[model samples]
Structures are given as structure tokens and as C-alpha cells.
Target: MELLKLHLIALFLLPTSTLGFNKCNFPAIFNFGDSNSDTGGLSAAFGQAPPPNGATFFHSPSGRYCDGRLLIDFIAESVGLPYLDAFLDSMGTNFRHGCNFATAGSTIRRQNTTIWQSGYSPISLDVQYLQFSDFITRSQNFREKGVFQNLFPEEDYFSRALYTFDIGQNDLTAGYKLNMSTEEVKAYVPDVLGQLSHVIKLIYGQGGRTVWVHNTGPVGCLPYVMDRFLVTAAQIDKHGCSSPYNDVSQYFNLKLRELVLQLREELPAAAITYVDVYAVKYSLISQAKKLGFENPFVACCGHGGKYNYNRFIKCGSKTVVNGTETVLAVSCKDPSTRISWDGTHFTEAANRWIFDQVVGGAFSDPPVSLKFACNKMNTSQK
Candidate 1:
């Protein structure tokens, strides 16, 4: 872990040319996604992700589901922007740089059930787009009033900012939770991506130009999926992931890539990059030991179970055993050395590692670095 940290530190110190990129002076960033990129939308809307979640960096439950920063946070820092304050949050939010519309349980398509019913967010991707649209108009109005001009983004910032998306993971899991067959889940991917496409177009219509889209990761390797879902001995891969589930996730990503290509054709002014975080994440899980980590399937902050997880008692929830109160340890003693923070989200360390790999466009479709994402690339350039 120390070695990885040092390598990342050195990576940040290198020149722009060494990383195959030029600098882009992005004044702001607008993000829309699920928990993977959600800074605080879900936490503020529901309840804050209770303690140990932000222990690694924020030093408190800073409304994130993981131990520290998410990929969005890393991206923000790299681009010289402030961490996006959740749009739902009315607290000390600063929208001057940007706003985050992502919630923890958000999916691309709206679910039939409420948050309580399906454990999925009612604020789906469409709702997020609405929120974003509202933010633009409302914030502008508020700024015009001159009451909080400093708290809002400049009118031109929206058009100049980089837009990021890291959703669709929950959409895949939502189907599995409903006992849908893998084929059934795969069948509806087009519909899901259709909604995603609509939202991106909506953003583009609103003047969003540089778009960054991350494909979903390997859900099968997540402790939450492995513990909650049923997988036979043969179903588990050599890396201990559910092969069928991973296949479904990969299929979702493949279609998502196609959608990106389609969007590029439709939106001539937009520079869209489809990031393959799935490959980077899967490699990390399958080669955890070689990558300097422990069993990747185990939850670092969960209660006792095969994967140190219980769907009923989540990472921050408590349980009583033998009349003794026990809080599922908010964080493990060595969370920095682990991958899964609470059976679902990645650890701060893991998030950092993932950020390092993808920032250089190594895992991106256009193979254009994040700094130069505004320039549309030829697919054949790589």
C-alpha cells in the first residue's frame, strides 16, 4: 500500500507531456451518476452515511458511502475544482464550481418501487437531469438577484465545465434483486442505455460539451453481490466472482460503449469519452495479492458473514448479540490495505488506485486524457 501511494505521488508530480495530455482550463464540473460518483446527494437526501465512511480523508461521515473520497473527488482535485456539493444538500454547499446530482441508489431508468420498497433511489437518472436543469435556472435566478452571486456558477461556467457520469451499476443489480434471469436483465440493457442516452443529450442541449462516462464495474466481485446473490460452485470464477453476473455487467458496458458511439454521431459538438473502469476494477479484484491487497471479496467494514457482510445489517448499522451491543465496525483497522469498504463501494485506497489508472486515458475509449477531454478523438487514434 505504501509503495502504491508512493507511485501515485510520483505520478502526480510528473509533467503533462509525460502523461500524454495537454492542460484544459475547465472552470467547473457538473457530475451526474450513482454512488460511484455521488459525493453527497443520497446522503443528504436520505441520511448521511454514518461514521467511518469519511474517516480516511474527510475525517468524518462527509455524506459519502466509502471510507474517504470517491472517483469524482479525485477528478475534481485533478482539475483544480472544489468537491461538488450535493444538489439536494441545503447546508454549506458551494455551486460556484459545480453541483453533483448523483445519489447512492440512483439508476439510469426510474424504478417502479420507492426507495424503501426496492432499496433503489427514487431520484433516478431522469430526476437527476431534472434537478440539474432546475439548478441551472434557479441558480441563475438567484445570482441575478445578486443575493448569492458568489455561491453560484457564472453563466458561462456550465458550458465550459466537464460533465461526468458513473451510473448503471445499480440498474443491473436492481434486476438481479428482482430474481430476473441474467438473460432477462441483458434484454433490457438497451432500454436502460436509451434513458442514459436521453439524459446525455439533455445535458448537451444545455451546453455541456466535454462528457466523461464510466462503464459499470464487476458487480459479481462485490461483497454485497457475492453475499446476497446465489451462485453455485461452478458459477464462481477463479477470482471468486460470479461469472454470469460479471458477464451481464460486461454486456451492459458493451452496449453502453455502442451508445457512446451513437451519441458522438448525433451530438457533433460534444466530446464524449467512454471509460472502461470495469477492466481496471476487475483486474484489481482478480489480482488483489499481486496488486498489494487482501482478499478482494471480503468487506472491510461489514459484520460477520462469509464475505464479512450481512445485507440486513449494513456497514453503519448495529446488531445485538448475547445482549451486547455491537456496531458493525464503521471501518476496519487497515482499510487502506483493503478494497471493498462495506461489501459494495471501493475503499479510499482502491478509489485512488482506480483514479490513477483512468486519469491518463489508458482505460478510456477515445484514449484522450481527462485534461484534454474537450477534444473529440478518433476511435482509431489508440
Candidate 2:
């Protein structure tokens, strides 16, 4: 009788997430950020992501930087929603499941140089929000006009849809590129996060109630950072990643988490989930062998360097080899065993693995699964 009573108590103490009644019925997902989630914003504005970019799944350039799908693709699939169409992409677009406002090379704070000069996108975070603002009106107009009605989302979906953000990595790298020290980069994090919080408030003003924010990943482990930056032997961590860069990334995440907490108080109606992508990514890179992956720091597709990365000429760049025209930096025969596709981006396999790790809220603040991220937590999640 005592054993039966204890089992009943345990059953009653189960979290609400296990209950089907508490699961969110999010009809759509609106994503915003940089290349990590950029479906095709940059491609639509400039040009298509060339061949070998989406060779794994799409079998063609599907406007993503990775070899196949991204974490956003997995997130959408988890919720039974279709892949999000880029807001900037006008061709064959359907916004019924919301749109992606992310573009490669984007930064929270606008850069001083042009894309050609600094490799940063002209479309900053604020610009993306503006595009989103315009999209809200434009989609409604198209719906009312009785033209392209099927391509537009329902008017009420905006309020209930999950607003996801996975940016701020560029902001950290931008500072490093400008020759800023770790302390200098840390100094300006507040401003960068201020802009991020401002945008969240803007979304809140737009009646968005559910917000999902992914903290930046391990920037130190990226091949581009390792090859581009001069790192001393002592700076390399056990995983062969630059410790300084990763420290800066962790600091940025710390500040970002604080900002998210402050925003939670600032917007009582919103349920904001701060995802620790840094921890998840770092764990994968650190334990690559055990998890069945190659050297985590090496680029799967690149021309040269210890990391197989060349910043000047990226993947898919064309060159002449032995008097014949050839495509430079083609993908490896097997990308599933690799962690990085390009020097800067994760492979589809790595993305899928990362998604699997965090899908159950293992790395989320307030300890809520994506389905229940909208519910406000009264205490810190385990």
C-alpha cells in the first residue's frame, strides 16, 4: 500500500510537458537571424548559393550555406511545419507557415564597411525587422487584394506563431575583425544585446507571445576563425579550438542570457526561451570521436590550410587546375562523418545532431521544450 501511494505521488509530480493538454499548437514559425538560419535571404538579394552548397538533400543550391538542412529545418519538422520560405525570396514562396528574415553576413549592429569591403551584409538586424514590419502589412494587403491569397499567411497567425532568433554571432566576430581585444568585445556586448532586446520588444508590440532565442555557438572551433586569427599554441583548447574566441563567445552568451531574463520581466506576456547552443555545439566538437565525427576544426570543403579553409576563395569558387576549368573546394565524398561543411557553417549532419540534443529542452533556459516554450515559468527549469 505504501509503494502504491509513492508511485501515485510521483505520477502527480510529473511536469505538464508530458501532458498532451499543455503542448502548444503553434500554427507557424517566424525566424530571424544570420546565416545559421538564413534559408535564402542573402541569396535572393544577391545571387543563389552556388552548386555543392545544398548537395546533400536539396540536390541543388537550395539557398542555404550548409551541405543540406539547417537546425531551423529540423525545428520546423519537429513542429510539423514546412520549411520556412525566406521573406526576401519572391519566387515560388508560401508564407502560410511564416517566413525567415535571416540573411548571411548579417549583424545586430550595422557595420561601417560594405559587403564587398568587410563581407558583412548590408541588411542588419534592424533592417530585417523593418522587412518584417513591411511583410506584415504586405501580406495582409495581398490577402485583401484577393491575389496570391494562398501564398500569404492567415492574419491571426502572427500572434500565435513562434518568433525564433539565432543571431549575434556576427556581432562578436565583427569586433574581433576590427582588431578589438576580448575586453573590448565584452564592453560592447551590452549595446549589441540592447539592439536584440529592442527587436524582441518590437515583436512583442506586434502581438508575438512566444519567442525562441538561440545563443551563439562555439566561434572558437570554426575553421575560419582558426585560420584567419593568429593563435598561439597555449591558446588552443583540448579540442583544438581557439580558447580566446570560445571564451568571448561564452561571455557573449552570458550577457545575452541576462538580457533575455531582463526582457522576460520587461514583457510579461511573452514566453522567451534562451537556448544554449554554445554548450551543445562545444560538446559535439569536444567529443567528436566518441560521437562519430572527423576533426571538428577542419573544413570538409576548402582549398588549403591546416584546417582546409581559404578565406579569400570560399566553397564553390571556380578556378583553373592544370589548364582546365574546375570548381574549387568541392564537398568531401562523405559529409555525414564531418562536422563542418564550410569553414564557417556546420554540416547538415552536425546540424541534425545539434537539433537532436536540444529538441527536448536539455539546453534551454527555464527548462521548457520547444512545444511548451510559450508557457511562462514560475521558477528556473531543471
Candidate 3:
């Protein structure tokens, strides 16, 4: 309880950016990934979807899966930029440097099926990178013509852009839910990583040198997975992350870190940083009582008792009528206070806290050591 108070105090004081740290080296950020890092690009595409999650904050679903902002938003702000608008948003095109290509429920592959069959655009990461290449080409041509109408000139804009990739949760979760054995799942992991590597290479080819690659988090701890897989509630731990799932996540992260090092050696010009978001996140949840959080596994959304979820239904949908199998969840009274708003994503407030830690360099080894390679370009121009 004493610790929970400290955590709460941190929350209250967190927004002021008073934690005293070096400012972000990158001038702008370009984000790509699934719901974790997405800024509502997917939600907007699903137009006419009744007041989505962002309804509470924006008075409508502003494309973000959360009530407001995700990790990318805070990261942008930390560096003195507005939250990056999704690439598809009209206002998003106005942002100078960054654009979010991440769509909710997206993956690196075409065929991997997950819990939410509402699979994002048929385009995989490979196609997404191709799209990115096209955008870069367009931006360059626009700049050469002196049409500074876009956010910034091509040189300064793309050079300073920080590329962030946080995805793969859905792919892993999908495999597990299908009852695949550990070895079978492990076999598929390499393919996923290979796709990630290909994307990284594509970005490097596009003159993006500052890459922040995020590995999978503790997928086992998610409420839906825990409730479905764990035999006893006691197995859910203090923070609600399932132990077995976390174990697999750790294994993945370990391998991912090694992979990042290999990628760095391959693309020496880029500033590559490996992020262990899971470790930092786990720390906060480990002492949840001190952080003023109860039932980390229990989603703020969902209906019904216990899990408040069904494999067949989604949140906010009228799945049940007349006490039948409805959406099976209810959003919390104040989503801002809850760590998690749904079975798979964190609330906006929670996301901010996580960003604060990462920006403060909590998740990286040897701290935030990546320098802006673009700085050299800037000096050369002078």
C-alpha cells in the first residue's frame, strides 16, 4: 500500500515531465506496428463503427484503441512534438516528421490467424515497408520542387525521423490460442523475426538510421489468455500476467536483443536501440499495490463475470441480447485510472507512464545512448 501511494504520486507528477532527464535526441518519430503503437489508423479505416474507445476522450473513437494516446503519443511529446497522427488521418498528413503506419491487429505475415479475425488490411509488414518507400519517394520529389507544403523539407524531415516498431503480439497470441505446442510455436517465431528483420532492412534502405525495435511483451499476463489457459486463479500472479506466457515472452526478448545487435552490425549507420518494455512494465505491476492498481488481469472493458470475455466476441459489441452472450464487458467508470482498458491494450494513462519510463531510459541497456546520426547530416549542410 505504501508503494502504491508512491506509484500514484508518480502518476500525478508524471505529466509535468519533471522527472529530469535528457531531452530526446531525435527530432521526430515515425511509428509502425499493431494496436500497441498504433495511433488509430485502423479504427478510422473502419468508419461508421459506432463511438469507439476514443469516444470518452475525443467524444468519438479518434482511431486510437485506447480512450486517448498510446505510447507513441507520449514519445512524440517528450521530444517537443504533438502526438503523431495516423498516416490515414487528414490531420496526420499535416504533422511534419512522423506518421503512424501501425494498424490495430496488423502483423508481419499474411496467413497468421489470431483471436480477433477482424484482421487488419491484407497487407503485411513487407507491403507496409513498400508503402513507406513510396511515401519517402513522394516526399523527396515534393521537397525538390520547393513545395514545403508538407510538414518539413525532405532532408530535415526524414533525416530526423525516429522509426519505432512495436508489434507481433497478435501473431504470437494467435498461435498460442490455437493450442500449438511450445516447440511448434518456437518454430514459427524465427519466421516472424525474419520478417521483422526484413522490415528493418527496408527502413535502412530508405535512409532511416534511428530504429527503436520493440520485442513482444508478456503475452501470458493478458487477462483473456490467463483466464483461458491457467488452471487456477493463484497462477495469475500478483499482477495477473500468466507465468508460462511470460516465460515464452522472455525467451523471445532474449533472442530479439541478440538479433538487434546483429542488425546493428549490418546497418552500422543507423542508431539501433533494443527495448525491453516488458521488464519495465513488469516492475510497475510487480508492486501494483504500491502503484494503486488492483486486478491487473481483469480488463476495464468486457462484460460477464470472472474473465468478462468470450473467445467468439469482441469488446463493446452487442454480442449478447436479453442476457445472452453479449459483448461480455463494460468499460471502467474512469478509464484514465485503469492500467488496462481492454483485454489486450493499456489505458492512455498507463501508456503515458510506460513512455515516461522508456524516455527516461528505463528499458534500454546502457541507457538511452543512441545519438542522432542525422546530426552529422545537419552539420554537413552548414
Candidate 4:
């Protein structure tokens, strides 16, 4: 009788929702994009990201480009799932939750014709889909063989999981690198969004019913671009960002939102929501003082410049300046108080703040809270 009483007490003390039984209804989360959402994907692929990159949180390089966790990490944690492991790092990976297919320098375009940058990305959106297919096949085979039966999800896991996309920034950056005019870059939006829509439709066809897509953030505020273009005070916006770049970002976002509406109509069974990451990001810059950020424009990890950002001496590099060897990407004394990380990405603190705003439902279309979106039923045609 005493033991029974103890067991009852223990049950009451336990959290309502346990691991693998999330209240949000999402059994897993699969992500695809570039550096913004990449955890260790780039490092696993090219072995490029190194030290001080993950200093603020992991205290060691975790292959994330920022000082800490990205927005995707926060989202995974919010939904009661483990951090999504990079697909390239297949060893010891726990795919029962989800997988990350983002690469640091990846672009949506398959060919280099649209991308001005050199080299080829083996894991483009199309390639990431292929990887997902392979994973599905392997898991099915394992299940059929009755191996780790309880370790994997049911046969319809993809339809129940959340599919997220945070791409397109790299393509725009490439266009700028090639010295394309604003009009020329704007013209490229249709092609980029078309590819993105194609991927979304493909996922839907493959049983993905809930998709959350983040629009491109304000690239104008990145110290990398501001340092290069905002030579005069007049060129900077009130928020200390490059107006030209922000304008381009705004244009892209407008078109992306429109596309989301179209997708919603076409895929009535799918919960296709657009997340306004740009507004959340820009808010941090515009309200830096209120947000407790001492330096909103300067990069937390960079070298030798007004904003401490040098394209040649990017973060995690070393260079000799004036006969003295200096670490190119030295971190600031307090990364938590800063906004930008390496001129392009946010500090972990900033990312956390952004996540808080995004999950609140105000920044999402159809006004569905992130938690609700995850838990909602899929209306996609069977």
C-alpha cells in the first residue's frame, strides 16, 4: 500500500509530456537552408567552421557559424525534439527526431550560372531532398527487418513532421557579388522563388503536410555589406543599415509572402506558413538600446575595420597586420551583449530573442502560433 502511494506521487511529479510524446504533435523536424540554419552540416561536408564559432554556448566549435545556437536549434528545443544532426555526419546520428541538410555556402540554384561564387554545392535543395529520400528508404528497410522497431517513427512520420526552409539569401548575395543592378537582382526573385515553390510542392507530393518557411532576413544590416558599401553617413539608414540592401531584401520578402499565399491555395491540405525573420532581425538593430545591445552593427567576431569586418579576413582566420600577427576573427569580450556575430549571422543571444518573437504567432502568416502550427492536423490530400 505504501509503495503504491509512492508510485502515485512520482507520477504526479513527472512532466505531463515525456520525450517522444510531444504535446505539440510534431514527432520530428527536418530543415534545409544555408549558413543561417546550418548546425554542423558545413563542417561535416567541407570541414570549414572552427573554434570561437561555438564559444558562447558549446565552448567549442559545434560547426555553427555563430557564437551559439541558431534559430533552428531553438525551434527544435521548443518542440521537444533533439538538435537536428547534419546529414553528412551519419555516424551516431539520432534521426528519430529529425535531420539538418543545410550547408554554409549552399545555394538553391543547381548550376553555377546563377551563383557568382566559385565551386559547386553537392547538397543543394534538390540534393537535400535526395538525401531525405535515402534516409526514408533506409529507415523503411530497418523497420521491415524489425531492427530498432521502437527507435523509429511510424510509416507516416514525414507527413506528421515539420518541414522548414530558410534559404534564398545566398542567391541574392551572389547576385550582388556579380555587380548586378538592383533591377537585375529583383528580376532574379521569380526564378529563386519558383525553385523554392517547386521544392515545396515536391515535399507535399512526398507526404510533408506542415511547412514553415522563413523569409530572407535584412541583409542590409549585415556588417559585411555595410562595411563595404556604406562609406558615407548619408548612405546608412536610421537603423545604421545599408538602405539599398534592405530595400532589396524588402522586395524579395514581399514576393515571398505572395508566393506563400499561392502555395496555401494550391496545397490546401498543407499548413504552409511564411515566417517574417527580416522584421524580427531588423527590430534588434532599430531598437538596440532598448534591447540592451551596446553595438548592433559591429560584428562580435571579426578583424580590422570600422565595423570590425573584413571580407578577406573573415571570421576564424589569422592575418599579419603591420608586422604583427593578429587573429583575424577575435571574439568580443561579451558576445551575449552583442547583436551580430561574424557580420553576417546573429549571436546566440540575438538568435534566441528572434526565436521568441517568431514563436509568438505575430510574425507568422495565417496567425498560427508556432506551437499550434506544429500540433495542428495536416489537411493534405492522402
What C-alpha lDDT do the candidate models reach, one value each?
0.87, 0.88, 0.66, 0.80
- Which has the greatest TM-score? 2
Question: Which candidate achieves the best lDDT against the true structure?
Answer: 2
Query: Candidate 4 on 1-382: residue-level lDDT in tens?
Result: 3323533543443333323223457888989998899988878877758678999888998889999899999999888888988888855677777788888777777656522344335577888888887877787789899997665556788888999999888777778777887789899989988988898998898899889999999888888877765446776787788788888889989999989888988887887878888978888788887879877888889887888898778788977889997776789999999998988888999999989877755566654557767543323211
Provide the TM-score for each candidate, comma-separated.
Answer: 0.93, 0.94, 0.82, 0.87
lDDT of 3 by residue, 1-382 (tens): 4434534543443323323433346656778788887776666666422334775656776677677777777767666777777766654365566677887777777654432464545545776677677767776777788786566434666755788889877667657767886566777877888888888988888678777777777777676676666546565555556776777777777777777777867876876777778866776567655667666656676665465555445456665577786444457777755676676778777787777666643455324423322221111000
TM-score of 2: 0.94
Which stretches of candidate 4 lie above 4 Å from their native place? 1-23, 111-122, 147-153, 229-232, 319-326, 374-382
The CA lDDT at 227 in model 4 is 76
| Residue pairs of candidate 2 with colliding backbone atoms | none
**For model 1, which pairs clash?**
none
